[model samples]
Target chain A: MDDLPSLPAKLARLRHAHPGDFNLSRIDPAAQPCSRGGKAADKVRVEELAVELDGLQNRFWADRRHRLLVVLQGSDTSGKDGTVRGVFGRMSPLGVHVVSWKAPLGPERERDFLWRIHAQMPGNGEITVFNRSHYEDVLVPVVEGDLRGKALQRRYRQINDFEQMLTETGTVIVKFMLHISREEQRVRLQERLDDPEKAWKFDPKDLEVREHWDDYQRAYRDAISATGTRWAPWHVVPADSKTHRNLMVATVLKATLQSLDLRFPPLPKGLAGVRVK
Target chain B: MDDLPSLPAKLARLRHAHPGDFNLSRIDPAAQPCSRGGKAADKVRVEELAVELDGLQNRFWADRRHRLLVVLQGSDTSGKDGTVRGVFGRMSPLGVHVVSWKAPLGPERERDFLWRIHAQMPGNGEITVFNRSHYEDVLVPVVEGDLRGKALQRRYRQINDFEQMLTETGTVIVKFMLHISREEQRVRLQERLDDPEKAWKFDPKDLEVREHWDDYQRAYRDAISATGTRWAPWHVVPADSKTHRNLMVATVLKATLQSLDLRFPPLPKGLAGVRVK
Candidate 1:
């Protein structure tokens, strides 16, 4: 962790902006680049940031000028739910909405890929979190070999265009790809099986998907390389340690919200002096 | 507090099934029929129930057998958002989804009221909360005089049929009307104006609606009477005290979930002996 930069600088370093020559393997998932101290200290910092986020979220909700869309993408057991609870849970449910995308059903499959996604976008002054997002369209098909060559490239371009359009509007998009090592995933999957309460989360299909781990990684790298734009850049979060994962996500989110300079809408004229009787 | 019944009994007493001559004014908004103790103790219990709700939610999501839909209807400043935070916040965001309904927009206005609502229903094993729900169509229209006489009656019948069909198809519906007095609403609305942070929540239109409070209350009584069914019951929750409100809602929800006999899907065949490696 010695060479790790400041939080903002580390965010910059981890961001996937322009395409080409991006390697997912080079990044260490266990690295604590955003850690302010050891486990106990980081836990406290995460709690502090969560409180601060709750305050900012209230103001942001009141501002009504900007909309925030946070996208969390990762492999099975990559901590998407954990990240949401740790980072975004402090905000009032009125302000923050979470959409956990699953496989398309009848009506959804009939429409284009982005149709369902467009319907779930945040309204003015709302923050929306997508658990597994549109990126899954690019990742799943590619790894399953159902989409390839020019077709796959076309989808990536489509996603980039869609995100660019959203950003051009009032939406601020923050995407995080929770990076975890295969060994860590193994442990998590095993724990799911070993713990009776978690048994239902252990899907047999997840094992089938794990067999294509390398292919999925390659797909993720290529997808990120192709679509990560300045408008909706992707942040690679090292998530081996659950505490550090929460810490890194909280740090990045705080910085993004701070940069927005959120403020409550000015009181209506003469409203302050008006009394409610 | 001594008069407070057991959670299950309280839930039964609060439920308005087969509603007939149900008087909204008869229910005291300041009643603490669900409170276990004073404000501080009730607050602690609310927190505890929230955590338990979180655990049950995990199993519910994993169970994937039933869909839960919670509809919260109240006049403005009746604490819809507050109840969500105080009661539902502890759950993992992945399992609980909240859809706060606003006035019909362009496309929504083009469609029938239930069209937009049907599109947002929870899938199997998921819990969906509607902050302000399809019931708004009945209240707003009736109060505005746009829908009345036979037309309003027809809509209520339509809603009953819709809800019955949902329940028949494995959805468990719980509806709550957050009952607050006009004086309480006035105080709450005033607090919103005085607190700069809360000013955004205070819409001028709410004041206008308050002028028609009696009409809205009558509309609510009629609507709830027409639509309350054995399959989908409505609960009148005294919501003037925020702590008691949360307690009541949480208690009802916890009882509802418990009644389902929610359990994790039986361990997949021989999965207990299966190794990740």
Candidate 2:
């Protein structure tokens, strides 16, 4: 990450590499379907990582000056919610703000796309998370032909400038595109169909998008290549294994926050007289 | 409380009567510095009220529509932070937001007082707790002479209308004024000086305000009486005893949210498929 001058070249090399493509069978998981791993090594590492993240969360809370923004985007069943809950489970509630941007509300729809995004920015010393963000203006509209031809291309330029402005204004944007294979997605889709509680999460339209998988992939690749920059690099996370994906994300966050050099400010002198008990 | 018409008369009567001066030494605390308590019948009733409030928090989370706004205002030893921590400890992080307003930043100081307050308003179904809010425009500035002469009266009018607007837009505002005695304040201030960690919380300037305690009380009484409405009533809680204060604040919150008649909305039928394994 320190090699900021050559970040574009590095990202291009990553974008060009062959991606992971492993799809396993669909299994009907019981009440305890959420698992880390049975292996001792995995358990120990996850525990250590959890503790480290807790410390990081405390530092972020205590410093209360530097801010972080994490942008998560992925295909259906890519585990955006799961990733957040797993990684930030131990974080202090005060230090983190999670905003799940749904279909725009009345006032939001009337404004330019970035209007709502800008409104959700965290104040100093906090973290703001975007479940899916302004990137959708480019990705969804492009692949779905919701904004076709000239309109679709225009969105790309607007999004790039929007992200760049956010970066310049002390917002550290970490965008993650969770990459899962078609077969793996199919399994998840089936699991959703089978579980009554999860039935609400499924959409017939989602299957239609699955049909245009290659088209969406191309759109994603183009979007990443066109917009990723030194200020905000898109990390194309391998999502076939949930554990591995969480680890990679945690590591990136740790490195980035550490680089920022956050520290607790010195307490003001002689405040003992303020306590009530 | 359901009999609002009669309750207003009762509140009027309570306002006219002089409250017995607060004595901190008599009431026993059951947490933190030491845990001891008497099973007072009134305390038991308040504790039950708090438990009911927890249920309301769950309902707010489920409904995602009835947002609760709690405004805590008082002199220094009012237990605003403690009330938030104790009462909302079990509430879902997803549905709650706490804002502690201190001195305004340069940009904030340039704007009208309500500017920063409006920015922190919670979305639908979210509960936002403000520790010292827009009322400070009148309370602090009026006492401090920061806004001299005619300017002071304008702020009170503006704050009243701003709060009315929030109520009109479905935001329930419950304001509280914590009342403590001079002798009790002296004991708490002394305790803070005796403790190492609490020493940093004291300010010599706090004593400047303490000197004009009667002036502040008069300002508070006028502000509350002028602005308090049926839609958003102000509750004056005796807060010399930390346990009694925490319980009273919790009781007020419980009553306010429960009055909203919050209920969970049905899940979108389409997302019913997912089950946690």
Candidate 3:
């Protein structure tokens, strides 16, 4: 009943167990998980998964019982927005919503950290994609030395509590920690600067955050370890290869959706065989 | 040099020592701790404190190092709006800002309970008054039975952590639990209905919460108990008399600002005695 090896095995390897067990540095970003063979095949698989996802999403929308939240968290230029487009582009926009988080500004910054993120949660049967998320609260603050020790631990606990509540209340959360190497990031960031089409995405402020690359990696590992739960588990996505990143994410989404046993909801009472008015 | 009796003693009595030490049911709503004889004199003193507050606010604006956050929490018609007017009416609006927290709606409800409140915090050299505040998250949900036991405890902890951060980052927080009786609330609710001018302020939803009066009282007690920390202590202000409420709040503001010993930044480097050309 389950074709688990290629998909679950990779995710299982990537799935962080606890704060003490996970190490971020050893995982190679270039290593393709759930790959078919090469980049061309991986791209083809992404398209297939996108179509299956579309079908599953339609059922998901009709089922209207569960909510799906795909959280894509990574450093800048690790392709969050691109992942959204590649993995979810074919799905109908009506049920699929994407929110790209940024630095909390005037209104967002004034309150407790999680307000903005919570306000953007997907309603029942809808799939919401977070380009970056509340995880950034833990990361940026940790690396910049703004939040340390107990404060950081508290945030992790807060997130776990929040996700547990979400799961208990019907939100099926699948978090992806897109793993990319420092070298790969440098190349991608350079592309952002070099390509005029991509130059607009580059922030000089990002370079400052990038300067804390190793720190962010450590932050990410710590965050993943502390926050990953049985309910909302973290899956590390090797994202150096665009094809592999999209493919792995799309495949995971398919597996997640399929596991739900979603179906088009039955007709309402007294309308089972009724046609249009 | 300190006139301690008429101020600090009252606050000391009202100040909750810890969650276990405070009992809401034992406190009288009609008790006036800081009243100077009668309503007429108290009203006049409110005007005087308003004047003093305006002067202190100017110094506070110039000081630019410390921020003030005054949190007002109470049942409906506990005189939050009236206190804001009577106490802050004379202060220069440039330095004093008021945020009236409402029930979290569309954008606000989606995030964690604290986001909206956090976004509304005062910047340095400013006094921000919260007419209603983050305390509502703990109170309302508890009264409505949406949160219980450990979940409730976690929220209180989250609040303490939040307020701790605010205080550590230069914000001085004064939280007031405006204590009003069930009878006072009935009279007030009746006024809203009887007075057409006040009818618009009435929400039908409020009546439902009002019905849960005892539950809410218990919730408030629990909230004040758990959240009242050394950094941000809770002061229970008996709010039956609007004049006393305003007078007490105004006097507290005066005391808080005076203790800061704010002085204008010494005429910026070379401009100590320079005249405008």
Best of the candidates, TM-score: 1
Chain B structural similarity as TM-score, candidate 2: 0.81
Q: Could you tell which candidate, 1 or 2, scores higher by DockQ?
A: 1
A2 in model 3: Cα distance from truth in Å? 15
**After superposition, candidate 1 runs with Cα above 4 Å error:** A1-7, A103-112, A145-154, B1-12
- Candidate 1 lDDT by residue in tens digits, A91-154: 7777788888999899999999999999999999899999999999999989888999999989
Residue pair clashes in candidate 1? none
Q: Across residues A46-122, which tens digit of lDDT does each residue of candidate 2 receive? A: 55676587677667766766678898888888878667756764454456677877777899889998898888898
Give the alpha-carbon lDDT of every model. 0.87, 0.65, 0.77
* Chain A, model 3: TM: 0.94
> Candidate 2 lDDT (Cα, whole model)?
0.65
DockQ per model, Cα: 0.56, 0.17, 0.01
Candidate of highest lDDT: 1
Per-candidate TM-scores read 0.92, 0.66, 0.50
Instruction: Sort candidate 2 into its docking category.
Output: incorrect
Report the C-alpha lDDT of model 3 over B150-229, residue by residue, as the tens digit: 98889888998998899889998888888898888888876665554454455666667777888988888888878777
Off by over 4 Å in 3: A1-6, A17-19, A275-277, B1-277
How far is B272's C-alpha from truth in model 1 (Å)? Answer: 3.6
Compose the digit string of candidate 1's lDDT tens values, residues B116-176: 9999899998899999999999999898989999998899889989998998899999999
Error of 2 at B47 (Å): 14
